[model samples]
Target: MRSTTTSASPLPPRQVGEIVYRPRVPHIMFSGYHHQPDATLETSRDLWWHTGDLGYTDEDGYFYFVDRKKDALRRRGENVSSQEVEAVLLTHPAVSAAAAIGVASDLGEQEVMAVVQVADNTELDLKDLFTHCDRSMPHFMVPRYYRLVDAMPATPTGKIRKAALRETGLTDDDWDAEAAGLTPTRHH
Candidate 1:
């Protein structure tokens, strides 16, 4: 067997395990779910490492992440999944790629907005696309605003540039208002 070693100096010690918030330490506690009852650094019996992602377990022991604490959307008392909306848009034959973002609405809730890249030489009917969404997805999940572009802005690693999209609000200039003739119903 080949030996495994790092050429550089050893890195500083770091804690690993399931992280729990502790008010006393003003620091996070990490312990293995299957190993330690007390979160102590000296304990070395953990089977899993604590990730800083905020999550909790129910009484039945099912764990769920509460989403990124910073960039969560609050839409009419419902939490919208941007990823799920993007996935639905990708199913459209005309859409080559898509990104969904939340925009603040006048009704004190966020609205789903989509930026879609259409296939080359393909022109999609906006009304048909909206009809498709209405039939397939829940009403709340449908994008309130849509923008079509040649391609989506992406990072070096091929991730959609959500920050850039969020910075640019959904305005009439960005949309083909004539193509999307359906008027949006004003929500109170």
Candidate 2:
């Protein structure tokens, strides 16, 4: 197999259960990965190439790209988009920046965790943030864990490093809403 310029990564097959841009019928997605036959084989199956993206088509047949499959959170048996969660979080006046990621759940799935940076001269109130999030999105999509940080780990290009946030496993600074009895109940 000849190596093409590049083919990105394929998400872990376990996370591929929900959303991915796979070719239903035979189509040329990519030539092959450079010097990575295992990766090539992992992505291509039975003449189908899994594009490792999380999304769904609306009733009108418009494909909505949610997140990378690897970055998506599986919460309460639903696929949650970290990007969508972050978008809701960012709307809060106290949040300067936010990064939503998955943390391990006792149920052997992933739970949504939001790492946030507060705006200058503003204090982030977890309860207020929760109420805002609850109003802005579905209950399951609201973050279960929240961590307020002075600054988010970022690349030189200013992209939040979600990988870095995930590496900090179960920190004391992280707040668990379930333990705190903060539920996202519907308001009148």
Candidate 3:
């Protein structure tokens, strides 16, 4: 169920790409999307079911899933890992939970963004967060846009529902450091 590339060629470990699979057994593949022929056609291409999950395969053929294809962001020619950004955000005391998503950009493929949740009665300081992230991450990885929420929309299993957050992306309500002329100059 995990594939790095469609071609049968040796690749270095952890070279991330869309994970895909084709049934190894005879006629064991899933039929089609229920009442969604378009989706099925889109998915079943080149004899592989393209899983939207981004991942990589090791030399041992073990697959390591990274980010979702849509969740991955490229900012100013730098690849930004959402999980890495979220890890730094979670270190802040004011941040109870955070979700990093890609914002549509006219200048590039996408820009980095942070959707965060703070505890009730707790104040989330934008300056401090900017400083914290500036110290922990490179400039390209630091979020360009930030939005604070009372609580994050979550999946049934308690995972942050980033798909839902993407619905409200790059909102006017989000605090923009660049607009305020406060985009931190990266030191590390």
By lDDT, the best candidate is 3
lDDT of each: 0.61, 0.77, 0.81
TM-score per candidate, chains pooled = 0.61, 0.75, 0.80
- Full ranking by lDDT: 3, 2, 1
Give Cα distance to truth, residue 75, candidate 2, Å.
Answer: 1.4
Question: What is the C-alpha lDDT profile of model 3 across 107-173, one tens digit per residue?
Answer: 9688788888986678988878888888899888888789988878988899988889888777779
Model 1 residue pairs with clashes? 17-49, 17-50, 18-50
List residue ranges in candidate 3 displaced over 4 A: 1-12, 27-29, 58-62, 155-159, 184-188
Better of 2 and 3 by TM-score: 3
After aligning candidate 1 to the native by TM-score, how far in Å is the CA of 51 from where it should be?
Answer: 6.8
Model 2: lDDT of residue 127: 79
Which ranges of candidate 2 are over 4 A from the true structure? 1-30, 35-37
Candidate 3 clash pair list? none
Query: What is the C-alpha local distance difference test score of candidate 3?
Result: 0.81
Q: Which ranges of candidate 1 are over 4 A from the true structure?
A: 1-60, 63-71, 175-188
- Per-residue lDDT tens digits for candidate 2, residues 1-188, read 11111333433323223333454555445678999999998877555456676555555555567787677888878878899899999999999999999998998888888899999999888978888988988888888889999999999999888889999966887888889888877532
Candidate 1 lDDT tens digits, 99-128: 878887878978777789998888887776
Model 3 clash count equals 0
